[model samples]
Target: MKKRNTCLICLQGLSGSGKTTVANFLASTLNIPVYHSDVERKKLFGLSPTENSSLANLDIYTKEATIRTFQKLYELAFEELSAQQSVLVDAAFLRHHERLRMQQLARDTGALFLIVKCQAGQQIMIDRIRTRQHLGNDPSEASEDLIHKQKQWQEALTSDELQTCIKVFTEEKNWQETLLQRIYRYIS
Candidate 1:
């Protein structure tokens, strides 16, 4: 069998947009590993992926902490991509520069890179947030307030970045097959 070049798939979106759901789906269906920044963040505090709300490290959401978290994840991504394993990064990626750096990492590593931009209607996202919080067993730590804050500050993707992104409407459909086939194109 011929070896195909690996891909680095970034699942980027705001909280409650179904990034993790899609990431998990793709990883299971395609046999790829999904690296979630939220889970990793919690691990930094010696917590489990689904710690209680009271245990939430609200103060760790600062700018410096955000940068460090993404940086650490990106380094791990680079290593996995270099080893020829297609990997998924599930994160909000609120910063355009952070997304850019990952794109450049793929370019430098000779790995195919694609951004799966998850989006849903505002009300849907809000509802999902409430549902996830109510359930309290998911890895995400976003509150309704943080969702609003993200809406205020989330940097829209640049035109250049959009060129490499495949938008997934979480409210509408399960897009795993389309995403899988697209990534295959990069490998082929």
Candidate 2:
């Protein structure tokens, strides 16, 4: 008997927006694999002790390398989907073009594309980052300066894309519960 193809849920957000946390929860609940870009990159390329390694230095490559990396990831993801496996992609897809490309990937692969945008108050985001840093579990490795830079970029986000994507305002309150419910509703 042929099994049905599973959905592909892409969690897009800024740094420290709980993309990884939410993706982890959703994958665990749905029994799907979470494909984290940073994790996969580290596993594939091995890690470096230098703060600015080759891959991190590639951040200044006009986004061409980043686009290519995502393209390859989509191809790999589609192969898994073809085998009837669900995948949760956790990445900071800050650009509108990246989101559109993922949408196209979903359309081409016949997989459901759920664009989830996780957000939070500035203070809460800063607190989360600090907590993670203190615990030595910060995936973003974003410092205060980096967060400021990210805020500058996010402030430039167009209104149209903000409206289209799912906005999850997670504060110090029941942020996890709200995010879980949103994911459940989208996937179910």
Candidate 3:
């Protein structure tokens, strides 16, 4: 069996590092569903995906709002995993502690926890973000400025986290297959 009944795939990366694209790919390939942080963040403020929302907007991305979004994201992922469904969380989880929280949730639920740190070159990220924005109706409400902000404050994954982490350099051609094999090793 190459599939676990329940596994939490948490994607941690900076904005425009290709988290969303990879999340969608993983979910589609592995028959899982994704709970996107950006989309959920917008929902927290009663705004739709295409609507304007930003970290600058305290009402939408306030400290309290961020906490609530994470809480709700965890809630949704927990519920889905509890029901024996694998879940993929699409988020730029810049904080190590929040990633640990998700790990703990998996432990509490007896599900496999895997943190996939997605990475790409700076130019690649900027290009991707620009393209996504140009496409219109992007689910992420984050500004391109977030790309810079995330780079400044990101708590990069540590050696301790490497045990359960699969590092995927999204710019690499074999990255997707590499991650799938790594994940199948745990789930299967």
Candidate 4:
């Protein structure tokens, strides 16, 4: 029997870099399940995705919370992978360690692992954050300050990680379709 093609697609980048958008696009196009960190983080705390953690006196973005959130994401992804299904994860993945853990999960499950790093111009990122904040509907509570901080601390992919990685510049027209094609070609 031929083995099924399954993968853990990690959509990663700094906040406001269009990771969520790309994840959604890929999820729909590929008909795969998507697990978003922000939504999962809030769910872990018994809060709605758009609920402000600060307003509830809960800092879901704390170090411990982040660890729990990633663990939850990994577990969720593992379930899908173990079931022979492809899964997409949307997260900042700001640290190399985070990516490493996910990579190990993929390896353990015998699923292909691919990293899609979504990017936009700095100004566009700032503008997108502002617009999302103004609308107040996104699960992500990333502020302009948060994005700047992420820029300072976000780790670049190592050589090995780069081998399985693709960069998406989201500001261009038809980016989703282009990226979809690229992902299909890469996986094939």
Question: How far off is residue 170 in model 2, in Å?
Answer: 3.1
| Candidate 4 residue-wise lDDT, 1-188, digit = tens | 11367889999898889999999988888888999999999999999998988899988889999999999999999999899998999999989999999999999988889999999998899999999989989998999999879989989899999999988999999897778777877677
Question: How good is model 1 by TM-score?
Answer: 0.90
Q: What are the lDDT figures for the candidates, one per model?
A: 0.82, 0.65, 0.84, 0.90
Off by over 4 Å in 1: 56-58
**Could you give candidate 3's per-residue lDDT for residues 1-188 as a string of tens digits?**
24445789999898878888899999899878899998898887787877766533546777788898899899999998788788999887888888989999999988888888889998888888888788867887555798888789888787777898888899998888898888788888
Please list all clashing residue pairs in model 3, or write none if there are none: none
Q: Candidate 2 vs candidate 3: which has greater lDDT?
A: 3
Error of 3 at 157 (Å): 1.7
Q: Which candidate wins on lDDT? A: 4
Q: Which runs of model 4 end up more than 4 angstroms from their true locations?
A: 1-3
Q: Give the candidates in order of TM-score, highest first.
A: 4, 3, 1, 2
Q: Cα deviation of 144 in candidate 1 (Å)?
A: 1.5
List candidate 2 segments past 4 Å from native.
1-5, 48-65, 154-164
What is the Cα-based lDDT of residue 131 in candidate 2?
83
The digit string of per-residue lDDT tens for model 2 on 28-58 reads 7778887776655443434432233344654
Q: Pick the candidate with the highest TM-score.
A: 4
Number of clashing pairs per prediction, in order: 0, 0, 0, 0
